[model samples]
Target: MKIYKYILIGFLIVTTIFVSNHGGNVSYALFYLAIILPIISVIYTLYVYQHFRIYQMIDHKTIVKGELVPYRFTVSNEYFITYRSIQLKFYDDKSQVVGGDTTVEYTLLPGESIEKKTNLRCNYRGEYEVGIKMVVITDFLRLISITFPIQSKYRVMVLPRVLNLSRLRILPLEKDAKRTLTCNNPEQIEMDNELRNYVYGDSLKRIHWKASAKKQTMQTRKMTQNPRQEMNLYIDLCKLDVTGMDQIIIEDKMIEAELAIVKYCQKMGVPINVFYQQDGPQKRRILNAMDFNKLYQESPKIKFNQKVSVHELLSKNVINMGKCLVLVHKLEDALCIQLQRLKQNRAELVLLYFTSELEEEEKVKIGTLRSIGIYVREILREEELVNIL
Candidate 1:
């Protein structure tokens, strides 16, 4: 294109010199053509920009992370002029086009169209645009090019993938394992006459129907002692001060690891209490497959911009005894203090530290955490979850 522009400039200069030296009919005609040539090229570029058409479709608007979705896009020329030097650019930050080159160029004849069918894979859990992001159009004379950003964005929501684990290596699953060290096969508690409002994980058999009818609210018989030793899973929702892509990778891994543990517990018929900071301190109890399904559906929309930190939540709601699992991206001093406090309180702590890269300082902290009897697993990538957990 630069060479073409230079040639056009040289032609214009020669025409101007001829018309200046001898004002003949032929010189004037050449000069006029030279002046009008660039005008025609600009008009042609604009015409192609307006007459070009693009259509894109996907098999579904929502997909699991790392799963390929069928995608197709078509580029067509609607006008009578042949479309030349059209280029396509895709969004490669969060999602990618599979099994083909990403940068594609095409030339379409009048009323002709070109379609490409390929698979698209989203790399993280979130809502983002994918496929072609912009179109580049160049004139026939190759003197100029205009870039047009695609207005219609193909956005899709990617949910985290749940791994079905036959057994969890994080905690012992043996029949003779201590009840305090394992989440499976918790001892059932006996109910007392004291009644309270029914919680999500409360057993249906323990519901006090007579007290509920009188109080106009569902009630359940309270247990004298603590209930079953449920697994307390805490997910850190505090936003990280990092680049956009780095943040997505960290957050997606955290979510997927948490979900994989939840799925394992569900398979073992163990109740789990999930804790995170949303509007404030939020908790969700998963008791069965149906409860796990609800959490899976809402995973993609979960945000990481929480005002409260996981350390603050743990301080306010301390667990004296139970199996607790904490998922965090950063190892801060305050969070470490909280984890140590939980360990001192006889709570079985399993810390899943997620990061794209681990630092030397974090390695020392991991050693300290392990010294305090806290099971610490540093997850550098998503694939580590399968073996580490």
Candidate 2:
């Protein structure tokens, strides 16, 4: 109710009393006065609350990058029946409007509602909330107005883009696959595996109490194995020096290649020794996306044809794997010589290379590798794997 309703009722009552008490022409005057005042008050009160709504909304609670999110907003009048020129604004964490701004000119019949919807895409990572700072509603004459806060914005967490390797992306093999090898059971060996020693996530049965006391660090239980041939998986992930293409694009390519090889071998039942050339010590297990926390200690330098020393350490493996797969990065002369020597001992060797920028020299070299039975292949692009296989 507006002030006019209250004032109109008060005047009507007072006029009735005065007209009855005076009992004359003034009664007629009172009747006219009561009518005029109430009408005026009704008009003024309706004018005050006419334009009245703002709303912000999102279709879902979560979204991933490169995907679309549907946004919906609604505006309506509570009491004053009037038209509204409405605008919906959406903002991100940085308080910047991102994509969902809209305007509509419509009238709200008494107790009526109107809604609008739009689609939005987010290319960046992190949680974003969509909000409207203010909503304005007005009367048909554009003289009356009201402002209200939208109920609230919805929060959406956008996950990072997934890496998809389409073709010949090369990744180095984990420790060399030797002629005959077995991954020893964990219970038999005795050593700490991950550095930070042990944390809450590790199993209690594997705790190295002695080491924990001595080093004053959590010691994770590690199995002592006759060290198997460890294959260092070196990736040339750096693309900064190369101009023109975006870093994230290159990262995507490399990530795709890495995941494909990991998934492929995992499916094939091969036990790999994995490592990033930028870091020291190799990870012997095939990693999944959730295993990112393990890479915290790893820092690898990206190079065009990065080399790791796992091939050189093959002779020390107590267990043999029967073969070695070096993918993505090129084999150095020393590593090639070692591979050749190992091949004579019944171990198979495969060398894979890829690029949109391979030179003639590299191309010819790949042919020479085939002549030596190194099983070398080059892919022009990720999608070209169809022809290679």
Candidate 3:
């Protein structure tokens, strides 16, 4: 664009000087042509800008991290003017566009269209938008280029990748711990249809919304409780110690470990229920065959909140604590005490702490937790996940 502008300016200056110094028909004619050419180019560019259309499409709206998604774009010329030196710019630093140039350059003749497909690899897990940043349209002489703003956009949801942990074995509970887990004599199938105000750990499906509306408060139904102890997975995403990039890495690892455990339990046909913290409040969700999409949608919502600790999150528990599997990014004394209390209540527990580096103090804390009845593991990398979990 700069080169074309400089050439046009130099041509105009030379032509005007020649016509002024040497007054002749040939010089005058050249000056007029030089002036008319740019005018024509500008007019042609404006016309093409009005007639050109851009369309963007994606193969999938949601994909897991590390997966390549196909993105297709179509540029159409609806008018009689031919377009050359055209470029499509859609580069953004947040995402990686592979298999093609960031700015696609091509020519579109009158009443013609061109389509190009490229693969987009999303490294992070979250919601993202993929759209054309800008369209560069140039004239036949390449003297003028007009950039048109694109209003069309598409949304892509990148979910966390579930690791293949086929050979991974969950650490077994002790004989006494297993007995305690099985000895809870709650009826296998008893329906307690009692309506009460909504609590943190209540199932969303059992919400008595009609009563809630009438009473001007959220109400939930207390259903029959299962006697058999299912796996209780607790995810604590509070980030009070780490900051900046370190905090980000911790969050990612936490998600990876949590999802890996969830996927493993699902594959092995283990009855499991997830209790996680969101916005400083405890939330519960029972995993089932139909909850994959819901899980994906909610996983991104797990983020750092206030200065919350795992112990504080667990202290807000409303349901009976059973065989507990705790996933946390950081550990504190309050959390350790809570784990001790949980074990004292005859609950079988396993703790997986995801951290990149372990300090001396942290190692000592891990040792202390293991000294108790709690099965503890430090997950440093994805490869160690199988043996550690």
- Local distance difference test, each candidate: 0.84, 0.51, 0.72
- Name every residue pair that clashes in candidate 1: none
**Per-candidate TM-score against the hidden true structure:** 0.83, 0.39, 0.66
Clashes of each: 0, 25, 0
What is candidate 1's lDDT per residue for 1-389, written digit by digit as tens? 79998998999999999999998999999999989988998899889888899999999998998999899999998889899999888888888988546446689999999989999999888888999888888888888888889988898998898977766777744363344434554345679999989899989999999999999999999887545557889999988766667788788888988899888877666778899987777788988889899999989989999978888878865766478888988899999999898888888788888887888999999999999888888888545577777
Prediction 1 TM-score vs. true: 0.83
lDDT of 2: 0.51
Candidate 2's TM-score: 0.39
lDDT tens digits, residue span 217-323, model 3 = 99888777555456778887665476655666567667777777766655554556776667645554544545644665677656667456667767765246866
Clash list (residue pairs), candidate 3: none
Runs in model 1 lying further than 4 Å from the true structure: 99-103, 172-228
